[model samples]
Target: MIASRTHGGGRITVDQRADGSGEALQAIIGDVGDLSVQAAVGDFDLATLLTQVPAPLTALNLDACRMRFHRQLAASLLELETTAVGVKAAAFAYRQAEKGISEAFGGLLDAIGYATGRIIAISLPVIIPVAITIGVQVLVVSKILDVTGLDDVITTHFGIDLGKTKEQAKEALVTAVFEHSDVAGAVIEHVLPGIVVGFVGLPPALLDTDADHAYWPHDSQSMTVWLLAGANQFGLLLPSDVEVWEAEGVTPPHEKPPRDLEDLYLREAACHRGTDSGQVRIEEIVGPDGTTRYIVYVPATTDWSAKSGDNTTDMTTNVQGMAGNDTVMREMVRQAIADAGIDPNDEVMLVGYSQGGITAGSLAADPAFLADVNVTALMTVGSPISDFAIGSDIDVLSIEHEQDLVPDLDGNENPAADNWSTITVDYDPDELRKAPALRDKSDAEIADLFDSAGAAHSSTAYAASIALLLRSGNGSLDRFTAKNSGFFTGDLKKTRDYQGRRKHT
Candidate 1:
């Protein structure tokens, strides 16, 4: 007989020698069985009996004994339904506990995943749109500014004072866009969003300005544009008022043409014929107090064949303003300064709009102009001076409005130093309504009619900024000054008093 104990607290007993032997052996078996029964009844303990065994146990024999005992115990347990029922109950409890644990862990993982997803969703919209908008603005400004070409122009012209140097201007622009909250807000709230909304409707009201009377007397130092021609086969050559009056079937007071066709032909001959006869007309206006002023208006003789369209020269001669005649105009300005009683060293204020803006910038670039006439400041509106090289001697303040693409001059050179400031004004629809002159027409109708033939490119809010630049000195005409007086006033819907108030207010 052999016996062994299992880890589950069960004991097994087996009979290995079961032969028909002496009656003594059978009697011994019977005696053992009686002892087992007594043990089961609590008269003896089986564990104490095993410790009391006198024989020595070998390793092999012990292992064989354990195997035989396990087999018998398994058979005995199978025979007892009560033991099987207990085993099944324990297994069921273990499986239920495992299921509970698995479900709890899965819920915790799901919670974590759900929380992570929420964070990503909340941040993505703000981050993606802002990053993309900034990238687009940078690319557009860089392409339009074209600092490389500006640097070349600066190096070619010895005069400084265009604004910040190209590198400095670029850094300043970048810093202004990023570090200045107002600028960023303007871009996000007004510029970029408006662009996304598209130009279908009237521009935002901020850019609109009241149109002043055509003959309004500005300050002595005011900026002005003196148109020299009427409508030609090329297009209307006068100011907006003249064009409007003409459209209404009103006859404008006729004036002598500023230049004769022969003069234009001669000027063109000088360019194409390689002659020095392409002389510009210089006019000196004497004020009532006997103060003499000079104006050098270039004749429309510059070859615009390159820009002429549908591939044919359009009725509008606007492209002529951009041609190589800029050099001739520059020389004419220098000569005009020399002809004036003032010394060439005298500081002068240069002001122009559209073609005149181009002329002013070109004149500022000449070393001769710089030496003979000290340009205290240069102001341009609707001028594409972005393509011209600016000189350090002149401080420039350029004001442009949305949808006015003419002033986005394609050939502006580089700014000299921090002396140049480019301001982009948003257009306002309501302000146009307030303008008594424009009240009869809707903004869309006005924009459509005026914007055609490229007139909108040269149009500005109310010419108040241009007027201020012309009248002021030291380059200190704040944008607020213009905002308060002109088209901006109506667009903002603010009281007239708000003009002088702090911008933050």
Candidate 2:
């Protein structure tokens, strides 16, 4: 006989007899919540209930509709909230990493390119000969053996004598090939190709990628700036120990004639009398846009001996000498800019010739000037400033003649530290000398000689070249030229007042 037992705890029970006969009973009771089910069956009895029911029991309660099927639902909700916060944090980290990577990679590429370019430039010229030598040796040995018939001779003459010495004879034949006359010719022929290959192939292989990316617009601009400096006489050789200009009483005139047309005519007339008389003063020129421009002058040389006890001539000469002192001139320009209450980083243009050109170039290259002023363009004529280094950030244009030895300087290196983007304008000195008829036979007479000479050496030619450089949009130097003529014209007009004032009085 089979007996069945039913328990009311969200489960069913069954009992089987030995004959395999069994009865199944479903347990169902009213109002038995989760606690009643636990009470009806001990907590340890859940395993039996699960086995008997063969169904997942998340919660055993009367209100089965409200019971959750799995705990993962709640866990997933918590994870979703956490993931939102995590994503924001990750995005921020990624941005920082991206910036860091870009900078690192950019720096690395620049260094590798620079080093590789230098190595190729230096080593390519050296490796060609060595490669040729090796190739020549190989070819020469082959050709010598063919021409001298040394292999056959050695095999026939020494193989039998040595008895089992065919290998030795072959070695002898190979050695004899090097001694043949034809070997030299063959070596030369073979080495030529190797030499060509090494000369042409190695550098390309080493620096092809670097060369493509190594150049920049800034490089040209920088070189021009340095070249302009070098072309000007601004290249000052400072003593290791020096005194500041202020301490030395090295200052410009307090009052002077404006460097305008009337002043120029007056100074020019003074030159007729062989009287070295001129005055240059700085003044503020206001533009239509309300921007103020500083205008300085290149005064005619004057005799300072007539001055009173103050020795105004000496002071003028001293000021002229200061044009060669790059450090002093730079400081003065910086002070002038500061005194004008203008930001040094604002756009600045320098136009000067001869001594004035030297002053401008030196001031542009001064680190302090750079820190304070944003030099947009520099134009110098017959200036010897290109001897100095200019910053890569500035634009510098220079006009020089082949005969103008003043523009030429020593130890000019590539990737110039000062004027990296320097462009030199070459002109015919002979042609320049013929442009304007010579009136007087003095050193100053040569000034007009340049007008016809087409010579880069003359001040007139330099001035014309500067005008051309400023007008032409081509070349890195043009980038620094004034964008508008209004400021320049206004400043030029304002300079007339300081043209011919007597500094000695």
Candidate 3:
């Protein structure tokens, strides 16, 4: 059996119970009850039949048979309904047990996180002094070696040189300390939560200070919330006017709708290749029912530069997106959707990976966007979007890998709602090795590559995991597939590409 937990629709099911089963079972029970009620009141029109027969004894016998049949049918229907209730009750108990265990695990993690943050806060005074002492020791050691000419001697004789100059020596010492210290690694690992804890501990008065009262770029919001919030509040993280235009020389449209999740992911992956290939893919699908629907594919961050430039899908946008702030990436996509001529009444599905996923969630959560488009479904892979309060009417499927730390950046678990489901699979490095970028490498090289964090976040690995889920006969995934069948069965009406760049101020 697949190891998975589904929470939503007011029920929790571990690996044993399939998602949507309780709702389906309850519907059946309701139908059974309705049939039992109908059977109890139903008649065979026997009085009319007797009038035509013109034999009192025969007619009375026929009426008696009808009454018996009606009694038996009603009794049988009631028995069936009772059995369904029992089955439903048993399933509910099992599901509740699973939900309890899952919550326990989540609670444990929450406790640990809070404990760690509190400990760090309480120990900062001691930690700072200890760090200062270590730094002094490193400075003294460097000075001694430099003053005695031992640094040059070691460099010449043993090919061991820490640094030539005093400044370089200090820098080298600090670098060595960080490289060899697990403490440094731990600090980096917990930075996201640490910042949140720090923010949470601030006084209400401090947090309430108006950001507008401060100087531009040094507002109270930035100062109180730290760098990410500050950058956005100060306008440094704001996107330039996104100039979106129709992409030219883009690849031809597919003949049919995406066949599976992997195919959709691959399409999302394509958006990251380069801006010339187009940053967004909008497909107008003519569904089998003659209604038109749209699928918008958004890509991960293409640029990691500190400064926001032409491409709104950059590191700046990543920060803005994760902070749940308005971003140029989102604006570009929104504009593209409008340019595609998708009406407010048209059904739309959004697919995104990484930053794209965050953008998609933001769009789905935005009231303004909802007013402009009928977003029916959203799928996000390797995105930290738990904080987005998307509407329950939208069917949401968030796919994540346990080892991919990106989704954890939000510092919150995805909401457990009936309409929203998160599928988290354990990482397999073998899947990473099959990535196109790694396929041509040697075995040794591939082994080394597995150590990279990016390996776990690979779109290819995500796609491979999705393939396993599709084949795993998991009930939750099947239900999702059935509900969104419109997106997968349609013919590709047309494909449009749009690119945006931040306007230079």
Candidate 4:
């Protein structure tokens, strides 16, 4: 329920612990505006009719009555307009104030972080050698004790299991050092390049900046991968026609668009299951007004194998995605959209989870993809996609769980903008306990269960949290939905399910 301080001019706004109101305030304001418009139209019609009546009507003074009515109608209209404007102005001011305070605070924190990072980056050269020397000494001493049988004697008498203790201590120390400092980043940026090229057989040409730029600039992350894995045309690596095919299975028809974000997330969760379910689901919705909009459901990683061969949704694509490379999975999704008969000009909304979320963001930001596909709205769950530069025109709703590690992988916060809103749900064991399937389990058992399922990153947990936020009537959620209402209404035209593979030779 706690809101993160506004960052980058955006606020992660949601109070899950409280059901503040039954109706979203933004919806109420919209209703008020609609009613005002209707009233104004009715008044115009009545006034026109009234003007036709002579001063000496059949009974009363029509002129006086008309004048009185005119004054009353004008007053009413003004009041209604003022109310709507005031409410909107108040909300805007609140957000501006929040942004101002957050920016100031955030800037201070950034300054501190930069200073600390510089210190750590500089210290790494000195620290790494000392640590290695100490580690070798400890290993030698531990081996000597073990060979002399003093390790077991010490464990029996002094209750000191040196070997087990050192392992645990080493693990903790390494974790702490990496997590709290920029040591790993420093090593990757400055120290590891030469070591990797010499010891790991990496080609120097891959790291060359002047190397022909592919679809995306050969940035640091991409260059690192290229150095290690060797350079290849990303576009050639993924051939859509051969790799992607229609899933050969019957899926339940999409009769209607999802009623809310909760329902949308549930659909995303159900999209990918084992080999039978499709990794990509595209639903074409036809509205009553005959306008067509597409909703693309992209599920999380279905294949976890590190070695890529026939599966596009594998670990290799995940790495490519993180490196800002055009991944096979992204290509597969692009083909799925095109194969579904969706035109480049057709309005599209992409909903994704985990790795699927990253692909969605990347597609939204991709200039080549955007040239063909007009993605107007995007919803991502448990994804670290802050690096992607989504168009300002696109509406983005990112739902992240505080406990989920996936969203933090990007190492940057999602930028705040009018078109983008981030919802961060704090971990609550009570919510987990309320689930019928998990109700019988103890708190500890529930924690273990969530950990196994990727904690809050799991689609089920995201859907549940979204349900709560919906029930609570979040303004951010309402605003996002209101802006992209077309994507949530209309009869289902057809649903296309696509299955993708690597198609290695």
Candidate 5:
């Protein structure tokens, strides 16, 4: 069973619930939903080919082979829904079925049985609560290994190593226990509320389903978040004999206006300019009417949390960064924006990757920040901002790698407001290997995933992704272009800001 939906120009809910009561990965659910449509197309192609066959055929099981191929090809197609349209088409059909299902189901049981045919017509997707997905995984894990043993398995196999001392490894093992436990709790958080109301003879509707605090972790994010969280902790605790001085502040402005949002030259220009110097680069373009448009680019977190992980306060400072830790990053951006002497009246667009995406999102949502700067747009790649309640005025585009788990770390998505749009890209390493420059790096990156955890989180990967979207003529890309066309219209002046880490004794 597969289920997916989009509300009023609204974002797709990406409900993972399939046939029964299990919530599979969102991509799996999407692929399964399109099976029928794809089968029809395949059938058409086969029929067209069969017409060319000679009528006087020798004894052959070629027909059987064709049937087998049909089935096998379908399975392979389902493995990857090559285009966004194919994955999303069934969801659109499902929406239509839902509107019609209510009318058909209103009559008799016999009539309902007749409507069952229409149910098939409705599609193969089912809606299951989140509980089932978690329960199944938990049961499977229990059969294979106890929780404690699993901790050792994950710690030794999954956790990052910057050559930490023995004590640090021991500490990480202890921390892994909770990180692992969050897995089961993540399941409970989803199904428990709806279950409780039903058990108490209350309407399921009584459950507060739309709250900001739902635990909706995607299948891909579970371990990735753990790895990142662990990496931040390790980077902070693993003492280096030599004190490394890392600077954190934006550099003086470098004055070239960006020509196109999709241009790699511009993106590379923004990315290469800020290496190790800071978290964000401020670029300015002077519009015809004398209005300045500031494009503030924030790369993903350089470090997870604070370098010194002495206490729980460390969570607040982790460089992988957190929603609550927005202020720490925001202050740096805020100060940089100020130093750029950006006119309060100038339009601002924030762009970021991963943690920087979250930072970009957090600042855009803040009323105080918006009141001060005319923030007109936000573009984030592989960043999750479901917790943010941003307004409808800003034109927001969230680009996510379909296989990248970093964006789904929050377990929820940005509100489905009309102003907000999301585009999911697939940078599966297998596909990345086709590129010569990426070949060696892709091979060295372990498929064990634990070792190559940064697979889709790189700025380079996001750049490649944006390039794909542009070439594919993605609707979101068109919209993004039309919205920002005005900024590059007049004589352009580019400004750059620098930020970096400061070493402590």
Candidate 6:
């Protein structure tokens, strides 16, 4: 017998028998054993996976979210297992062919069998592992999505480009990928793992943001929304409900609505001062055609203590504010309208920032609330109100920042419609400081201007951006502000404040 060394780290002794065929058979067996071991490793690797990808919602008791994360991890492991099976099957097929051919040709086939074994030994092991890795990546994200069932993960869709240039590029890329499905499929197979893990890098709360699915395409902010969130915070900390008494009517029905969005932004900013006392100033405007506009302002999150008893049910948590029934928010709004002595049939236009924006949207969308007061238009900044299904007739205006991330927490923007519109701001501290309102502030002060969602979510920053937008002649903004211009250019109107308390049942 001759001893032959194989790649499997074992030596196989073959009978010489004056035939070279045993050399090939020994080589083939070694390759087969090594392949088998590789397949085994793949099978066992499932247990070793670090399956702790965090969820979008940042709460300790979110069992549902944790389960979904586990499901994705499990699905990935199963894909790995399938790859292992394919490797094992390939090994089995090679071994069987070698056995049958050897039996048929006797020792004469040894040279041919050995050459075949060399090719298999050299090629398949390298090929199989690479192919499996590619396969796992290709299937992992989709597999996770498949098991996601209609749980409210605040998941975002891959479509929708808020930029004209990016939208054009996206169209071209999407068309090409879909046109060549095979190539696109192959590319996706390699990159899907990277896509899934990228969003898991930073939790939004650290930067005072909510979780967003895609950081680049989906996440953004708005100062208007932050201000509203700030208002909510104020209300919670005061532990009081909010009340809004209508502004006194303009003299000749043309004196209000501010000279420009900057004027409007300042007027809105001024509302922030009164939030500490839990009273917000609101404007009730009457137009030439008998249209009425009720301007409402909301602030940020406050009252984060155990004073509220349950975080999930409290108005202080964004999750509760957006997801749960609007007990505190709706009550404050309802009382505001009622205290202002506005009739149920009067048209209401709601505007707010952050949590305040959310509360406004919730009020606009809630049928019960609408039945009592007609919500005609809504304008929000930095608010995640996408889940609120407001009426189509209501004029909706939203502003967001690409890097803000808070607006993305609701998973999507409202569907495109003529009455619905958006303004997206990409905030810059230098640009913001240059604004007249912030010009006098030092760089450090400018840097520290906005707290929650960075400079983009800053009220002063948004005020500057709005001033710029107004100057740019954006049609939607022009129309919204121009129609309400009576507040700034026309007559004297009376503004009032109302007090509110939470209805703790």
**Best-fitting candidate, measured by TM-score?**
3
lDDT of each: 0.39, 0.40, 0.70, 0.68, 0.54, 0.53
Candidate 3's residue-wise lDDT over 1-505, tens digit each? 2344555534554533533454566677578667756755554456675484668787788678878976887687667566656666776777788779855644444344446656677888898899999999999988998899998898899987665454567755654433333233223323333334443553222322323223221221232235665565655655567788877524566888988776777788787755522388898888888999899998788777766667677888777676556888788888999899999989899999998998999999999989998999999998878767899999998888776667766545688788888887766666655544556879887666554545657676686677766766656576666798888897898999887778877
- TM-score for candidate 3, please give it: 0.65
For model 3, name the residue pairs that clash.
8-417, 8-418, 9-417, 9-418, 222-230, 310-501
TM-scores for candidates 1 onward, in order: 0.31, 0.34, 0.65, 0.61, 0.51, 0.47
Local accuracy of candidate 4 as per-residue lDDT tens digits, 143-177: 89989999999999999998799778886665454
- Highest lDDT model number: 3
Per-residue CA lDDT of model 2 for 242-354, tens digit only, reads 12222111123224423322232223222212323333334455666666655433332234331222211222332333333433333344454555455654456665554
Candidate no. 2 TM-score: 0.34
Q: Model 3, which residues run further than 4 Å from truth?
A: 1-6, 9-133, 136-225, 232-236, 249-252, 274-278, 431-449
Error at 222, model 6, angstroms: 24
How does model 4 score by TM-score?
0.61
- Give the range of the ten consecutive residues with the poorest summed lDDT in model 3: 215-224
Assess the local accuracy of residue 441 in candidate 5 as a C-alpha lDDT between 0 and 100: 62
TM for candidate 1 is: 0.31
Model 4 scores a C-alpha lDDT of: 0.68
Q: Is candidate 4 or candidate 6 better by lDDT?
A: 4
**Range of the 10 consecutive residues with the lowest summed lDDT in candidate 6:** 1-10
Error of 3 at 345 (Å): 1.6
